[model samples]
Target: MAQARCPLPSLLLVLVAVVLLVPRAAGYPWQVCGNTGSFTANSTYQANLALLAIALPKNISSSPDLFATTIVGAIPELVSALALCRGDANATTCSACLVTAFQDVQNVCSLDRSAAIYYDPCILYYSNDDSFLSSADNVASASTNRINLRNVTSDPARFNRLVGALVNATAEYAAYNSTRRYASGEADFDQEYPKVYSWAQCTPDLTPAQCRVCLAGIIAEMPRLFTDRVGGRVLGIRCSYRYEVFSFLNSPVMVQLAAESGNSGSPTPAMGPTSVTPSAAGGGEY
Candidate 1:
């Protein structure tokens, strides 16, 4: 049999919106073990990876940008690693999350020569190949809430249009308006579901045009993956987006839009049962 090759690490781009109240939990992480190659138990590559585990977290926590990339060891045995924490995360949280990620990748991916791991608060990726450090390819993964929007079943098209506008606007702000490449906003929808909240973010290292391209790739997937869902997210190594009916992000929403008028939309239905929190974390290997 021919040997199979693992695909390149997929970028996860998340766009989420929630309906019912879901309990929030940290949840399990999504990980990809690359097909590039492997390292021996005590090889020089292993030593370099170990050094990165300690150094990356410290560097990211200390930097105002909350992002860091490093190259360790000479070529052949070299390792390149990058880490990014969500914009709203505190320094303490960013540091702690990366420290845990470094330990977790080893357990989950073992001695793989390259790997990528995703969590709610952060992302960590390392490899013998450095091409990914600057590349913003469209490889992607997405997650959606289990519940549908309360009114979406009545008028899915309208709901989708609103979501597209909100997400696209947020993406523009994250790319052009925010130095950190992060943005959150809300738009008025209907009387029953009065507001929709959304967020967008990209790794700070990407240029504005690169950031826009990264986010647009994921947004194009929204109609297929998240049309009527109350909450969904697409996560990419380079960029990500999320939306919810209820507010899930921090204070000071970055952008706001008024509800569109003139549409005699369908009658608002009774609210769904509350108290169910959407799953906070989910992903799949590409």
Candidate 2:
């Protein structure tokens, strides 16, 4: 039989199409460009923002808490910025995430004087208004995987109850027990999906009460946002929580619990507490 071959141009075109059609593994970043105002190019506000982009990443990566806030310039040109890395993210990852975030926000928001950009590893926000640097009052955004849990369809109410218990406990641990204001835990469910993993975090600068309130605000939206989904996350400026059927967190689970037998409401903590020691500098936090 004669050998078959694709034309060079045709083969190249097909390859290009395939590459272009492939989805980004990390997914697209979520961003909000504030309507507060816009800054003109080459303005002092733009210059101050440029300085912030360089300073925040360095400050956050070096900080023990993996969080940093700064104000550059003075008066109307002041640019206040905050950057926070996920508790499990290493310094390198945190720095890189923020560096890219600054670039991404500038590109996505263009000349907007206030904007926030979020990624899996970190979040960056800068504004002419300094209140955002300390306030936890921002609205949260939810991201849910399209696939529903196969096991949950059989008993959605039970699944919902379990999810509520898992996230609430995780939030409590993050707010109260964790030094970094972050925690991850697992809950035992039915056999079909034996476990549900959850993670909760808040900006380390926030007080325990503030963290709890911030997390509570987002948790309240779960029924409307997550339901029986296999995975979902609510991301906010000050706090966030994520849940999945499969494990998506680092080791040393901070809390473990099992659903009570029969038609009980909440899960009970498993015996023996698990503690996480904070990692060394350049590594992740507890």
TM-score of each: 0.76, 0.79
By summed lDDT, the worst window of 10 consecutive residues in model 2 runs over 266-275
lDDT of candidates 1 onward, in order: 0.73, 0.76
Please give the distance, in angstroms, between residue 128's alpha carbon in candidate 2 and its true position after superposition.
0.8
Candidate 1 minimal-lDDT segment of 10 residues: 277-286
Pick the TM-score winner.
2
Q: How does residue 93 of candidate 1 score in lDDT? A: 91
Top lDDT hit: 2
- Model 2 CA deviation exceeding 4 Å by range: 1-27, 139-151, 264-285
lDDT of 2 by residue, 63-157 (tens): 99899999999979999887888887899999999999999878878999988777878988788888777676554322222223443654566
RMSD of each: 12.8, 8.6
Per-residue C-alpha lDDT of model 1 across residues 1-286, encoded as one tens digit per residue: 9997654442121112232233231236767666679999999999999999989999999988789999999889999987888877888999999999989879977999887777878888888988777786533322222223444654555676677777887787777777888877788887657889888888888888888888887777776677677677776677888888898865467777666555534322112111211112311100
